[model samples]
Structure formats: structure tokens, C-alpha cells
Target: INKDTFHLSQRDTENHQTNLQKFCRICGGSFKSDPYKRSYPVHGPVDDDTQALLRKKEKRATSWPDLLAKVFKVDVRGDIDTIHPTNFCHNCWNMIQRKFSNSPSEVYFPREGTMEWHPHSSSCDVCGTSFRGIKRKKRSLNPQLSKKPRMVAGSARKARPVRNVKQVSNKAVMKRIANCNKIHLSTKILAVDYPVDFVKSVSCQVCEHILADPVETTCKHLFCRACVLKCIKAMGSYCPACRYPCFPTDLVSPVKSFLNILNNLILRCPVKDCQEEVVLGKYAHHFSSHKEAEEKEGYAYINKGGRPRQHLLSLTRRAQKHRLRELKLQVKAFAEKEEEGDVKSVCLTLFLLALRARNEHRQADELEAIMQGKGSGLHPAVCLAIRVNTFLSCSQY
Candidate 1:
């Protein structure tokens, strides 16, 4: 046995019957070693994309394994626990979903998890590479153990991801995890279990909870960051409390003194068996020590990634600000082409970007909104060009 790290390697060497579970049968990509790439069995109905496509294409619905066997001549019927079952990584699954043929547009590579896959070619028909251990002079351990994948496609049966208790049990981490879903965050959060009568003025109208990451509107109404966004979407771009027309850029942070009140609120840890009470302003400082949680959460920023959700929220806001800058530049450049309706084109394009590319069609929508006195605000770069005014962003635009 090697000294520094004892014989878990020995156990893995001696075990057998599960060596192939580490790879995707279609691509031969290694997901088990990296833990980030999404993997799924070829045996069952996986996602809505698969189901909808199956319903539209075939009169009789079939499991993925059945479909793969029929179309690709690849068989994956054996269960992994007993035999070497075929599986597919997310990229390979997408290729099959988009087209059902002998040749796919792209062929996933054996080292795909570490490197990019190649575009389809005639030689790719063989898909000729796979990495396997030689079994060697000493009987190598091939331990049979199920690993909880980061993302699996189906809900009917899914493995729960394991969390390190030691990581979650650390004092600083326990404090952060305790407040992960509980404290001030960008998205509309669950109502606090504790009373909020003292901070009633800042409570979100939709959630009836103390405002966490509050947003101030052009109409002077206040709401939790996601609460206002969701409300406006539901109300067809109208403000939550008032019917005043609003756009995403119209939501700014509250004034410094007003915000300082919310930031100063002391939160008692609501998670069970924890006694840490921390100031909202200082809560973020403790987050750096929680690297273990970061490893499990991976590179995602969504709330389901769990602890340090606030930090992720901050990152998301920064990315949006960057997007806003790009959008401003794109609008300014595109608007100059339609110089006759330059101001209106910039306004309408920012809102109806997903609509038709024709400027005339968008100009009509902008004219209607203008007639109704619902013109959206302009980005700072073009603020002088258009006759629109903006409130100073407390968080700094």
C-alpha cells in the first residue's frame, strides 16, 4: 500500500464488473473522472425535448435504448450493476435528438470531457477509439460504486448528489448555508420565518416578506429584485404597485441611506442547531472560507447550487450590467442605419429584440407605445440623443 493516500486505489483495482460505467458508450467520453459533464442512460425516456420529438416523429413512442438500437445499431440494454451498459453524454444525446440517421452532424470524441469533439466525417462512422485499463500483472481493483451526477436528464429516477458533511459542518460554512436561501438575494426569495414588522416599509408587495436585494423603479415603487421583474412580466411591462409602464433598465437600486437600513438588519440564524447571528452588511466576508461548497456547486450560478447564493447573485448582476453595455453599443450602431427613426428604433429594438429584424415593424410598435406615453428609458450613452431622462442608479449603472 502507498503511504500518503492509503488503499482506496487498491479497493478500486480489485473490483470488477463496473469498469465501463465510467464512460458514455456513444462517445466514450469520461464523465466519472470530471464530475461536471451531464450523463444519462440510453434506457429510458429522459427529457421533454426527447418526448416531444418522439411524439411528433413516430406513431409509437419508444425508449431511447430501443431507438438507438434500431437507428444506430448500438445496444445499451444491460443494467450497469450487472453488465457493461451503454450510456450517452449530453452532447451525444443532442445529436441523436436533432437527427435520426446513420451519420450525425457531430461525433463526440473519447477525450470529449477534457477536449472538444469533432465534426462528423466518413471515418467517424467507426467511432474507433475507447480508453480502457489493461487489467495488468496485479489484479487491478475496478470498484463498483454509483456516483450522483451533477445533472441527470430524468426525474422518474435520479440519484441525490452527495455533500461532504465536514464541509457543511464548518462554522463559517454552516453560517452561510444557513442564510443561503434565507437572506437578501437577487431573485424573489421565500418569506422569512422570523418576524419582519420592524422592516415592514421594505417588504415586497408580492411575497409579503422583507425586501431582499430590493429594486427601486422609475415609478418610485420598491420590490425585491426578481419580484418586480416577474410582476412586470405578468402585467405586460407595468410596474408592480402602480400601472406605470416599465422596462428592465428602469429598475435601479434604492438610495444609499434607505439601503443602509436593510443592510444593517441583523439576522438570527434560522437553520437548526446553529446560533450565529450576523449583520447583513458583513455576511459576505465569511463566504471565502466555503470553497468546499463551491466545488460541489460547480460553475453554476442558480439558486439550486445552494450555499453562497448571494455571491452568485452578485456575479449575475455584474454579467447583466456587461450585457446592458453591449446592448447599448449594439443599439447605437444599429440605430444610425435607420437615421430617420434613430431614437425610436433604439427604444423599440431594446424591448422587442426577439421580434422581427425589420426596423419598420419595430418602429410601428415604438410609435404606438410613444402615443400611449409609455416610451422606455435610454442607456446613458444615448441618453442625450433621445429626450428620455433617468434616475441616478444607487448601485452605479
Candidate 2:
């Protein structure tokens, strides 16, 4: 094969050496950068041990092209045309592809070089300390391993590995803590006194198992990532410790954090009838299955000339007199839920009342433009049109 195959070029070797040196410089000697640059793909006579050693060394090497080959399959140093720039390398790529195989490109790689983390800590929650436990990557990849085929549902599946917590040097961690010393810890809950007595140790409040990893809200309230997400799911973005309003995006790298927490917590599906306890990382898929099943059951609450979810219509009527004042209050309460987008359904109730109150609001054209921008596709526009048509029909009813 060596006689027929192209040998490693001088330039390729030089670039490989340079990348190795760069890695050595960045990681010090704690890791070997270019452990096997000389071990080219053999055509002839290397011993099995030597070949195995070479492969192992190649795995540890971090050169972009080399790592690219190991991670993905095509040699990045070779014909770049053979692989797209977006090809996955093996490290975590298989899991990523299987999990998020259906996600929109926008969600997967929003921008180049953009990565985020969720913590898996071992120390004081508020202080965000990493006391002694080893930081291990907990991935969410089981759904990929299943051989059974499943139908796709609303939106593409956005399965991703849970976020990893940032591993700053102990010095950097202390520095960050010091920078926020002036930010007072809430006196409302003493360190010794916790909301749940069993939670006295640094365990997550949600499952009440697994040592908790600290996550912060914009309000600086500290809770286990899992517990806080559950609180957010149930209670919205207000700080549980204090009533301070916080945004979902401000929930300490939320998507990554939630994914990490979910990945780590493999739980049985809570829906009645199906009791599969998928790992948290696979929850997106489980929920997708749940959602598809729910859709097959058809719209539950449709009335004459009215869409399903008519109880929401009553809420809309109530919101009209008070301008959805009740929902405004309750909205904050349910703000953290995955169903919050459905809360937009609540807008139907409010809009209906508004239609009764005045004609001075958005004309159809203005509303269409707004919907187009937010919807991102023909389906959204069609949906908005259907909802508008429904409300107009309801007025007659």
C-alpha cells in the first residue's frame, strides 16, 4: 500500500511538528502534543506493537488536521474536498450526530469557535468551588446506540451532550470569587439551613441524589443545576431564594447546564403508560416521542369554530377585561417551563379580548410581518394566519 499510496509530504510533517510544539507550549508537558508525528500510515513493515502505539499516540495528538483525521475519517491534510468542513471527528462526534442528527444548523454551530459549559462541581455551591472530585465528561449518547427506528416529530431533535462545567485553575476560581466578594450572599438562607433538610449535603434538590454541581442565576442565587432547572420549570425565572427576576438565558449557561444535568440524571419517563427511564441526555428524544404521541391523540379541546385548547380561550376572555392581567401574574410563575412557548397560546385569549375592546391595534399586515420574522418559515406564517382566522371565526360564534 505504501508503494501505491502517497507518502507524508515534507510540508505536512513540518506543519504537524509545529502544531505539536504549539500544543506542548499550551499544555506544558502534562500532555504530549505530537506523540507520533513520525509514525506515518505504514505501507510495509511495522510490528503490531509499534503500529498500535502509533495509533494511540495519534489519538492524543491535537494537531487540527491530525485530530481532524482521528476525530473524523478523512485526512484533513489530504484532499480537503474529500470531506466537508463540517465533518465530525470521532471523539464526541458520533454521539453529537446521533443526538442532534435532526437539529437545525443554527442550533448546532451557531458561530465558529463558540462553545459553552455547564458545571459538575464538587464544592461550595455559592462559592462555585471544585473541591476534590475528578471532573469527568458525562455524555448523553444512548439514543444513538438504539437500533430501533423512531418517527421524527415537531422540530428536529436537538439532542446534544450536556454542557461541561468550566475547569478554571484553582487560582482563577479564587480570583473570580474574590471579584464578587462585594456581592453579598443572601442572608435569607443560612449555609447550615437549607429549604430541604435532606439537601443539607451538596446534593441536587430535584432527584435528591448525586453530588450537586453549583449553578448561578443572574440574581446570584446558587442551587444545583438540576434543582434550579426544575425550579425554573415549575417557578419561572424568579430567584427561588429571592424574588428577583432573572431571564432564562441568564440561568448560568442554561442550555448547556440543563443538558449536562439531564445527561447525568437517567430517569424513567413520567408519562402514564410508558415508563422508559431514558438518561437525561436522551430526554429531548423521549419528550419528542411524548409530543408525537400527544399530537396523534388530536386536539383535545376544540369547540364549534374554535381550536383545541379552548380553556385557553376562557383565559383569553378573562385576560381581555383585565388585559390578561391574571396571565401576566401567572406567566412569571410558569415562565421557566418548556411549555412556556405554548404560553403564547395564552396570547390568543388576550388578543381576543383586545379585538373586542378596540380596533386601534395591529392591522393584519403589520402582524404578518412580525410573525414572519419570528416564525422563520412558511409554517409559522400559516399558523399565525390560521390563528387569526380562528379568532375572527370565534368573534362570530
Candidate 3:
């Protein structure tokens, strides 16, 4: 190899070797951030601290290296743990000792190869800790390997800042010493655009919304699966509507009667352009067709990063212009609609009040043009209509 290639290969090999040295032999986990990283050398004189610790627990061993070989199933014969860190970490050492010490073994693993004490104190090449004796510290996990606890079931409201623990909004964290036992974490049916139905048979009693993924309770009460699941998780196995035992085990199915009823019910498409009635059971299948059509025309896409996502956003100014055109087209369509019964009955006081309020001489040039004058080419009547509509629009809100 050339001189440059040789050096580069050497550097990569060194890095690979270093990474192997960081992992614990027992659990195959890192010790880079572990302060209590410890190991009982495969080649051992059996340190005094280690012997005493074992004796206190009424445990005896012929050889540490032999014990490790049997437990780990590795051919450990070296004085160094550079390639594979086949040395027990602090936590793993204590665990393995307690587990294996229950019943002492005599002839399981015959001590393999005689061991001799090094002249000087044998120290770890990784953390610079001595391998001669046990120097135990408060056991802690490597922060790099440690993970934050999973979020519990609830709206994750940001807690307001307070001076003391007493001033905190919720005492749930303070009261509990362990992780929450509630595993059924799902979104409430009330939060989503659920089916609208007046029939009580097809509705969830708990959420008061039309049933979504309906599940039956022991008390013959029906509810949204998410609603009951969350209720059982938070409030225990009693029915919310009635104090009947509603545990998951107590829940039973009434055949497919609920689904049969649901399949017969009609639902309107949520998409604004095509609000046609469809069978509730087939709504999702019908919606997928609209979705496919929209995708082909570049009208709908995944919001996440990709080519399809950027289709509308590629030319920002052009996208805005298209949006403006659509809005204007909608307004034109609304104007063409026949104004029959109750057309004048709708609220217009907000419009009149806003129009009069903006008709002052001190208004900006843009506002002046909107009202009337030579700046705008619109008729007086048209200007009044425009002013009324603009002021009454939700943009003001």
C-alpha cells in the first residue's frame, strides 16, 4: 500500500479498537460515561476486597477466570481488555454474584490455566482504574446509554413556573414513587372529527360522541374503545357511566351487531368539494379514492419532507398567487348564488360599524382606495360592497 493509504487504514483500525474497549463484557453496553466501570480480570490473583465481599455473603469460588468463562462462554486468556471489554461492569458484577451465589458449585468449571500476580498494580487501560482490588462507587448508568421515561397518558400541558414543590399544579409526580401502571394510552374520540349520528345505539355513552371503534362493556354499556381503554387505565376497572365492573377481562363482544348498525348508517365526506353521503363502514375506502385523485393532480401530499411535499412550496410567490385566485373564485361563486329567503336576516351590523369606522380622512392611502376616490377604478356602490365584505371578513378577527 502507499504511505497515505497505510496511515489512513491504521487510523481507522485504531478507532475501531477504541470503540470495542468502551463496551462492558457482561451486558455488551458502553462505559464511556460510567464512573463505576469495574472488572474482575480473567487472569486474577483474587483481590482481598473481592475475597472478603464473597466471604461476607458465604460464597466461595476456585477461580474468577473460570467462573467468567462458564458464564460468558468466551475464551478469556489475556491480561488486557482492549479488543472486547470482557470485564464485568460495576452493576453487572454485583448482579451476577448474587444470582450465581444461591447454590455453590464444586466441579462445574475446572480452573483453567495457572494465574500469577503482576509485579506492579494492574490498572485498566480504558478508565485507568486498578484491577487488583474492588474499588466500588455509587452505581450509576452511562448518560449516553440512559433514556428519558416515556410520556404518560394525558394532555401534556406545560406546568407554570412556581417557587416551591407545594406551588406545583399537579401532585401526581410527587405522590407516585414508580412508573405509571396504566399502559392503555390512546387519543379520545372527542378530539377527532368523529361520525355524527343521533341514534343512541351507534354512539359512545362515555364520550357522548358517535361511537368510534366501538367496544362493549360488562354493564351492557357501549363506548369508544379509546374512551374505555383510557378510562380503565386512569380510573380503574369500573364503568364511567355506571359503577359496573368494566375491566378489559370483563369486556365482551355482542357479535357484530354494533358494526352491522354502523355499516347501515350514512356519513358525509369531510372533503369540502365532494360532500356526498356514503356508508359509514366504507367511508375510509371512498375517502382513499379522493386522496389518490388529489395526489395525482399535486393537490394533496404528505406534509413531511420529500419531493411531493415541496411541490406546492417550490415557488412561494406563485403558490400565494394561486391561493389568492382560489379565494377570489370562491367569492365570485358566492355572489352568483340566488339570495332567496333569510338572505338579509344574517348579521351585518359588524360590517356597517367597521365600514363607517374606516371611512375617516386620517386613514392610510390603501384604506382610502378601499373606501372610494380616484385611486380605485371601482364604482361607489362597488367600493361600499368591497369595504363591507373586507371589514366583515375573519381576517379582522
C-alpha RMSD for every candidate: 27.1, 27.3, 27.1
Most TM-score-accurate candidate: 3
Clashing residue pairs, candidate 3? none
Candidate 2 off by > 4 Å? 1-251, 254-262, 299-397
Over 1-397, each residue of candidate 2 has an lDDT whose tens digit, in order, gives: 6644435444443433333322111111212223432222211233354345446545344334443333223343432211112222222222222221222221121111212222222232211212222256665566867765555663334332222223234224333323332222222222234345433333432233433445655543455555555566665544444434344565553346554643455455656887765654555677788888899778654466655543445676655647557667686556546455566655544564565457533343344445446542345566457557757976642
Number of backbone clashes in candidate 3 = 0
Model 1: per-residue lDDT, tens digit, 1-397? 3753446544433232244455566655556544576777767675677777777766354577776654344656644443343456776675556343222233332322222233323343212232234233564544663553344566524433334444334333323322434444422222334355545566665555567688876556677777667555654555545444456776788889988977776655443554466666765664433555667688664665656534424667666666468766777777776665386656854555443334443344454456457674434344332222212322211
Please, what is the whole-model Cα lDDT of each candidate in the order they appear?
Answer: 0.53, 0.41, 0.52
lDDT head-to-head 2 vs 3, winner: 3
- Error of model 2, residue 173, in angstroms: 34
- Model with the higher TM-score, candidate 2 or 3: 3
What TM-score would each prediction reach against the true structure? 0.25, 0.18, 0.27
Ranking by TM-score: 3, 1, 2
Ranking by lDDT: 1, 3, 2
Residues 38-73, candidate 3, lDDT per residue (tens digit)? 556546555675577667767666566665554444
